[model samples]
Target: MAWRPTLIFTIFSTILTQSLAKGKSDSPICGILRTLPNATSNYSEKYCILFYKTISHLAGDEDSTLYLPVSDALEWDVCDETEPPPASLDIENRYIFVSSENNCSALERASRIQSLGGAGTLIVKEKLHAPKQNNTDYNFTLAFIQNSSYVKIMDGGENVTVGLYSPEDSLLPLSLVIIWFLAVFSVGVGAFWSGKVRHKLYLSEQCGHVGEDNPMTCREPALPHEETSMNLSAKSIIGFVVLMCTMLLSLYFFYHILVFVIIGMFCIASGSAVFCCLQPLISRIPCATCRTPYFNIYVVRGTLEVRQILLLIFSFGLSIVWVVMRKEPWAWILQDILGIAFSINVLRVLRLPSLKICTILLCGLVIYDIFFVFITPFITSDGKSIMVEVAKGGTSQEQLPMVLKVPNFAFLEISNICHITDNYNLLGFGDILIPGLLVSFVHSFDLQIGTPCHLYYLVNVIGYGTGLVVTFIALWLLNGAQPALLYLVPFTLIPTYIVAAIRGEVVAMWHGDSDKFESGESDMDSPEEGVPNGSAQIVT
Candidate 1:
């Protein structure tokens, strides 16, 4: 119904408005300096003022105020308290440049510029420092610029002009929307696919009734060894967290050399992931079902279907192509596709058997994420987050392929303010895969219980989406890098627990009885009891 879409839109609008209202009211103003061609400089350059603070009266508007530079040559001593403005200097209606090294306070600098009839004052400093004293006495618009910008202006002579403006935050970046959709799609499809595979394996384990025409019905189940997923234990979760910490530190210290190694690993892993994701679909094709002769390789021997071989070649070829063309503008499409496939494959292969293990894993990772992203900045020399720096490529030309990147499609020029030149929003694979394990486990639990409509699965998936929205909201309001798992784990885990408790399956779900399939098999053996003879029940 049309009302469904309308209701969703209404909810989204409400959330957006509420989130925006919570954003920082004292957002910093940005400035752009444009240098015109002069005798010494042939080409023009535009520099962004990264560090700046605007006066109280100039805080409301988003419009840029353009000001031409004064023609007077600025000397370090010009703004000194001992030296007043030169007799010949004319600063009327022009923005005057004042360096912090002039041994004068910001208020004093602004007052001197105001007395000289200047339109505004630009104070250049190495870093931003709020005035210890009140700045209300001087009314002219005052802002700070980086020392580098000041040097450039001095070199550019009087041909430099600046435009100051406060950037308006986008209601929501389209990149975030796309990333959310991709995350939901990846987790949902991966869970469903995992459940289907689990169901098939469960059915294959059963000893069906023997038929005279087909004795193979009594044969032992021949499940593929490679399809066996690793069930995470409590200790393994802790170990996984430790390993993640080690890897992050390694990447931070040795990023230049290790990035290529990680790229190679991603190529192999993503290729295999693609093959795993596509093999099932391709197996259904009649023409592609041809099998190759069994071949022995050292201790292993197996026959591969024609489709499998073709998919292997195609998947690896695609991965190699992405590595070669990753710098291209359109390459994010391929990267996202491969990344989603990789996440789905990981969710399918790593089984969190119970709610207990899921809780342990999710909580451990949430702490890990928080420590690296939020805590390490205070400890590091450069005062940058280790996690954020590693994720941002850490001075390397190659970025880790373990994230889903969506190019920002917003019309606003907010990328410069955020210090992101590529204008891409990234969601780490851990954010999707860790919580996705819980989602997948719940789907399997739903299948085990034969819950009508998969209520647990549905609720957990919706919780995950809600958590992602909260993460984005926090990111927008704080205007900083966020630990997504801080929001994701609680949202996904708590809802599933609540649903389990309400359904009175809390104990069962917490332990996740693995023998349920065996019990179901035993029940299937007695055909006259209810189940049809020799008929297999497949959970869809």
Candidate 2:
């Protein structure tokens, strides 16, 4: 178990090193280009454009609106001509489109367009470059558009008018609030349920060891085979991270072919997760006690209760239905439900043995996330982050199922124009599961110490929520994707360590003395004993 943490850390470090070595420069401003609704073009209505303002003061406001008609430059390469083409009435008050492959710079082209009375200049290019800034004063907005957009506009003819606007921020706050609630709920419930399961397992183990002279009869309770939690080792954590990197790369490179495979895997995993979530609740029903005859199938080890069997079939059936109806407007609801269940189950099954291991895992993953989200753009062939690309499903029509997505509920006409009508605010499962492991650990620790109120668990959960709020604020301010764990790791780990230190239990928490609780005497006479300390054994 100790090896998992080390393995995860090493993998993250390797990814960071490789990304830093191949880094390149990027433009400061990338805005959205949306075609008006009345356009006759058959092309995509929206595009991502890199904008540069000639007026230094206007640089601060990327979201400022610029609505103008577009016109082709007299010369395809605006820089090829020595003097601006004969001024035409058609060019005045319109955006001039030009090829960027010409020898002249973007500034020179913008100056020529300004001289021609054009409202703005749109330079078309296949490759991106940082436009050289000049001190000379000019009064026009200049931007670079992909050749694809230029071709589409040209094909659409004169009816295609475009506008530049920043991505919408209206839905960010609401979406973040919802996500925060879901994450907190998942962690709290998972920790509580995990503690209960461990206590039950401990009691069962104690009952099994009762001596012959004891009057009490020992009867084994029917429990799930996967009752034991797997503690993460330092080396296994490194291996796990390495595996994650490999999987990310694989998805990026082979998404077209592998997307179906990933979808199938998600269905299976989500089905099992759903079963795990529903089993306890259904089992509490009196009718659920009915059992089916024992079967000799190698996969199923013991006789399953009637309700458990029905629940398993129903869970799988739901996943299948989701897959079939995934393109429907209401499909996201099912996806979110499946995703939340999966995250909670993961937090319950995976254990971080100590605070030290938790710190290593969180810190390593933060660096890994930062590299992929912020740094990989410079290194990848396309000027896009590998993490974002994979999350967006690359060229595949099917999105990866590892995120919780909430659609923007706020109504805005611009949202439709920008082709964001169906867009969703996304939070990856990693964001929840990684920090959640620490929350789970502290809750178990609280039980071991026999605290009156599980102080560490509550504090860390609050810290996670605060950190998530900060992350959303950063995203809104920067108007870009942020590395959430960068904020989460500090907010969660520091406060937890401070609490432990104040109580003078730093050493105990560091090494996870809770593991020793398993050897403590069990009170067989009292069935109502509180949760015991130590790792829970998996009953086979």
Candidate 3:
């Protein structure tokens, strides 16, 4: 009779507890385990821990294993879940919700879940893919899981245990700073230096033009000619048309056949770059009878040496393989090497006459960049900025072929300061090409007049490096898309002009008399080739 009384009391107590739990309005849906045992003891059970915000908010190590009533099986698509949570669900108090919507940002998704009685939220994201373009303006406050497999497992409703670790937080590491500064500084200085050397070698191989006051002067008529306003305007129009077409083509190709387009571009650019780099060696070749050095393989039929052909083939093959490998270390290195080489070659070939002209061109480009990036949205029918859209679109997998990227691998844990991500600095060809043209021209001016100061070229190169650093700073501070040329133009132009003025070479350079020689009116001394008689001669 005593044992029967004890059994009846125990059964009554169990029934009372169950009824009270069902009636409670604030019950934990996921359930709470207040006293967590050793890690080994909990291995047999499937569970997931809640992630707290930061180290400062941590009360103790004991709170690390807290869980909630959110079940792994109750994945909700807020868009599809138009109806409110049913009364039977009773997941109001302690449960969080999960969302992976592509329509909105992580912050917006979290806000929606919060409105639906979720105490917390988790957003699943893919690696290297940020919020969509429209959502980039807002910073997300929710925790994002990057592991695709883990997200799938959690979303699949499998009986699995998940551990949420706080994101590893760090500042801009010293290793990233050094690597970024060195890469920018070296590329600027090295490309300028290589272009100067190549220019000298190119000038040396030309016959009848040796020791000319200005090599650019030898290819034009004796009479000086200036570009008319109409001519300049026409050139502007043509240039704009070509540039727009190229941008459209790039945008199209990038989306459709990214790997193939990138491979082709790399091959063409790197191949030409390698050829130009070998110009010095090619200039050393001696003709059997004439015993003269040759400057151009293009001008001389069948003049390409076997090694030069082989080198071109190898460079192209490597470029193709690198693209096929999706830019692995081997391919990445090749890309950077070729990018530098291409930059040097472009610097060597492109030229601007004077600081005044350089300033004017740069200022105009600054406006172009700014208008496209900031003002286009207001003017467009769709109210979307073309520059920002292009930067965001076709970038789903992080393969931007239009821009050359140099990865910072010096410290595996550090993020490069020039990047929004933890990878590399993205530099568009326009960033290098336009400013580099003027730098190369200044170098050529140095060679022509033999200026003792030698400060114009050096100061201009330094100015360019300074401009690049400023660009990085602007990108970080704005936390949005910036037209790099806006900063680049001012930084490059002012320092260069100040240095030129300080050296008292302003008039000489502005007039471009330093790079020209007074020749006879007779046509006999006229330039043999299509080279201009003066630095500023009209292209026509």
Candidate 4:
């Protein structure tokens, strides 16, 4: 066991000595890391050291460099080892292996290269999601080059010089950790508080008395029973088909137009939310004898307050600034504020009353995610994983407005070399919104039954947090892009269902029944109808 590392060091040392005779003191050639016709020219270097920039395997600045002349390996089906690449005594040559196959794992290819006496191996994966490499106890250095750089290296043969910049550090940024916790807590609080407020509003609407002066104080409103309707008429089906076609064509021809349209919608929604929040304060301002309050001029969807109008103006100003300046940091902050508002509103309005509905929807999505991400490649000759390609390409050039990037607090100070580097974590809204919906449903369920302290909401939120933690662990452990919903859907769904079953409420919950009130009721003042003493009975 001890001899293994020693043997590797010896081999590396031998390669370095051989490369030194052909080497110079100059730095490696600089080329932009991309693949395209206009990509930077590649430069050949007699000596180079491979660098690993991942979170777990960070090669330090002071690590020893092994100099070897780069050489290209002949293209072969690495999956079928029956015809392995011919072995050579040229241990001084670092090999580059390119493959588009799905059968062979990256580690397997690396191990095979080491057996063939490669000083180091560079794998150029054609697919978007590369195979995971868990075992680092290899005999030689290895690096995974992605996208355009791979093409440049392949075309340049031994002449391409590639460089990888070291990240701030291997440790997760403290600000990132703080932001993540705050996001989860805020989503939870938003969902719970909004649901409770909505419940109270529904109570007020159903019963006429809204003020403290009302006499019937003890009376509680009937639990809401939403109507579930399915209108699959021919006209509806035709309308759906037309809408889809229009969307596809619009996205194809006018992608930027769609982007601006979405921005406009976000402005309107954010403005309305700001107005709703400030309405009560705006109403208190006294107006002159016959004239209306100044805030009345601002009203659009409702009696919009002056501050709310200002919020809309500010939002529009920020959008304009982002377009003109292209200041990425500002765009990041503006997107974050808008994204949070969208999430809260979605959680507030979207309701899944039946337990059966939540389970079926989430479970179906889990299978959908796994199939597209992991299994589709084998079934079809698709060049890349659909989900991986979408996620990678969607964020940058296409500029798909699918995610909100949290601002890295560490980057606030302007310094050449600050230890507190910005660690902006870009998370897709679907990752937050989907689970938020389920967690919101559970909290609303708690409200419906008059449960104290939102017990079920806490459990389901814990399940969501656990699932997300496990998803990250799997990403590191697997060393590839994973469908997050593959882990999340099950973790959130199963535990909450178990909790419901244990309390003997699964049957009633599955059918969207409430135990505190009868199946049908119109008024809260009936002697038979009112708030429960404590927790309601768990109806089977």
Candidate 5:
């Protein structure tokens, strides 16, 4: 009775499965780890778990390179089959590396390394929960290249290291690229503006001189306009370069750098374009402030909330389409009808009822969205069911003559939602960028008395959101400002990296069973059942 890792791993996986919420399976974890930092820019992340499940049987472990999403953590959970495995309850409660990770509050994430026999078991979970999480302005974002053409074999004897890197690494490269492009475009625009300004001044001088100095007697040599052109162009260029470089460097260190990156990029592009191109052109025209740089804005739309209103409306419509695409209608029924009724009842008892209508409307909208966006996509797919089959000792495979064909429908079906939520994946700096720009805009128009402009207030509410008291005061004071929202829609496809790596590992794990067949076919699923010779189970 030699030690059997397959049997052991099966038990561990079963325990893990018991904790899953039907189709949910801690879906919020990924929201916290991947999407939030990437999209929201609201929270700081300390660490994450990188569950490495080998879909294919790996031969030797020397070549595998594991890249963890976070920089430092409290502990690592290694599900090794041969080693004395840190106590079961300890593994469950995460005592495996608790001593090293004592700085963090708790393990921020959990992951699994699922695979089949003749194999070593490994799962890496890093824990970093320091109380200083609040004091520092830090960003913990991760971008992994997990699924490549390499690292497929899933044999038991293998070694892997989960490499670490600091947060905001992705933003550095992305920001650098954007700033460089804009800097070049700004210079080109300035040159065009200088030409237009000169022409306007020439026309004015000629018109003024027609009645006085002998019908263009000397031409005045144009007053050496080159000096003025050089200064204007130089100022614009210097202003732009300085601003962009400042923002880019700021992102390298800020915890909420995602906001800076997104907002800073747009502001620099838009502001520079206007000052360098549109401003000069408009100045040459009869009117100065009358120039509208972009159509969706107010200077062009004439204080009509219609454009802003329409924008919000269109965004709502797109959100509706998103709900439809995700395929959940019941959630809509509950949120729109029942969720509304429930909120009214709760509000009635509370007695501070000015917001009853607004409350119901807001709650209903959120409820319907949840059903359409998050709740509706909870049904399990055929691939997910396949994991249960293999887990239960029911799957088989066959080996082809030249190449081995191990059909692991299960490996292809598992979820990657867990990994995405680690390290505030949803909360990135760019998430905060647009809002910051809005705040900057409001600052541009900041006033101490009377109501601020509707447009300024609108941008602030729709983008960054002033707190409840602030919103109340602003809306009370302005009465006409309507804001739009930054709606996030999660796509339906599983991340390509997670899908590819898992499938590859499943194939490698079943490599041994290939000895049963020659090539181009597997014995796991029989030809008679139309299961395509997928073989399984080897007692080595």
Candidate 6:
């Protein structure tokens, strides 16, 4: 929130901006320079003008025209007299085709606007090109001059553009840097704080309707019907579909070893959850009194405990180690982090009808994120900075942007300086799918299988939706979309996280055994009951 140097630059740029909204704003730069307001202030502000140059902001836009005045007093109207020849005579000697007219006799014939008393100024018109293909302009600024005195006479004749314009110098690059920082930094920090506050409330909760000793006495369960049987819930069907999808994703691995590893992890998660889900049902069914040791099916949920979950997370670090050990660039390693983080964040919040719905959505998000990174839609560089190619039409072919190759992985340049974090790739449909499914597994998990937090069923849903909407809005704003949506709409799904959290406080209530207050017994079965006196059971 504190004012910074970027803010200072914006204020300074705003001072120089001048615009005549009645003229070029309507007619564009091709027509005559119409009458205007104070051209200095109006144009300066209307078009972002700044003195400071940084790679962080230099990546140009598709249609931006950069006017670099070689000397302040040079006439912008006639590059024929004002704009100098190549800085080095050797530039023209060594490179035969340095000038735009060097190879085009027709173009040289067309540059004869002098016969009509109209002087032409060189203008470079840039178009999108892959990095190593047709990119000609590569200098820091176009080597050209502008003249105003002869501008009015140049409208009627064919003119040659003598300027070198690079696509790297685009329109209003990072125009509202300060504004974006103020907005996103404020909202990101604010939302993060809000999440913390809600988490605190969830952690420090107290029992309400459900008594610690007996939940049965506190009115009938809200979904007692759901508690009656396993009943092949919609969630189970979803699991099957997701599992199939997971198997398919396993095929995407460049190496078969990676496939086994990923699939093995998935199976571990599913196997553990399934085992836990069925424990209560099996416990309730009567078995003939046979002293067969094999019939004793004792369910163990400890391996999937919270600490164990944390351990599982730590295990993922091994992959990072392997990647680093392979001597990959830091960016690629970071892409992994980013890809996982982005996918998880999105999946944690999307909504679906059933637990299975979550599986599909999460898988979709993951696949989309990863695939996009691999084949991201930007040009790549071949170990050369693109700022020195002003030798004119005979320069090397330009490659695609944002597709630079690295030692092993790719850099995935989202922009010149700002990229897709340390470990992620481009946004693609399949990348969205796989990760979406994995995240869905987390969202769709039925905690009611054993834990005292069935309220998460609703709370997690709301949280999932809210988190998703928030993430999308954040991404949209980051990608130069309108930033006001987050304020205008409140995500109702966020309530789910809150509700699930409050349920956490009442955990003791749901986990304990039926008591005198719960079962309406004057005295409940004491420690001397057939089953363990106080352990809670999952009937569904």
What's the number of clashes in each of the models? 0, 21, 6, 1, 93, 78
TM-score of 5: 0.22
Q: Quote the positional error of residue 134 for candidate 6 in Å.
A: 14
| lDDT (CA) per prediction | 0.66, 0.66, 0.46, 0.48, 0.24, 0.26
- What is the TM-score (0 to 1) of candidate 6? 0.23
Highest TM-score scorer: 1
Give me the runs in candidate 4 sitting further than 4 Å from their true place.
Answer: 1-58, 62-165, 168-179, 205-299, 319-330, 379-381, 394-396, 406-425, 513-540
The residue pairs found clashing in candidate 3 are 29-69, 30-68, 30-69, 218-527, 219-531, 220-533
C-alpha root-mean-square deviation, each candidate: 10.0, 7.9, 19.7, 16.6, 31.3, 21.4
> Please, what's the RMSD in Å of model 3?
19.7
* lDDT by residue (tens digit), candidate 1, 1-540: 112222222111111111111212344434455555667677766555532343434432334445465433256454565666767666787777766676666666777777767877777667644444432333556766677766766677655555454444368877788989998999999888787666555555443334334556644453433222344467766876676677678878988987787677677667777877887787688886666665644211356666777877898899999999998877899999988887787677656557777888778877877888779999999998787787777777777777788866642354444344455778877778778888988888888789889988899899999999999888876867788888988999988888888889988887763344324433322223222222121110
lDDT of 6 by residue, 452-525 (tens): 44343333334434443454344444432211212212232234334435656324322222232334431212
- lDDT, model 4, position 300: 35
Model 1 RMSD, rounded to 1 decimal: 10.0
The 10-residue segment of model 4 with minimum total lDDT is 14-23
| TM-score-superior candidate, 2 or 3 | 2
lDDT of 3 by residue, 51-142 (tens): 22321121233237444444321345544446555454444433343545545555555566667565445554444233322212222224
- Return the clash pairs for model 4, or none: 35-148
- What TM value does model 3 have? 0.59
| Alpha-carbon runs more than 4 Å astray in model 1 | 1-30, 34-47, 53-72, 75-77, 81-89, 97-111, 121-162, 207-222, 226-232, 283-310, 327-330, 373-386, 392-398, 407-423, 477-481, 513-540
* Model 1 residue 524 lDDT score: 24
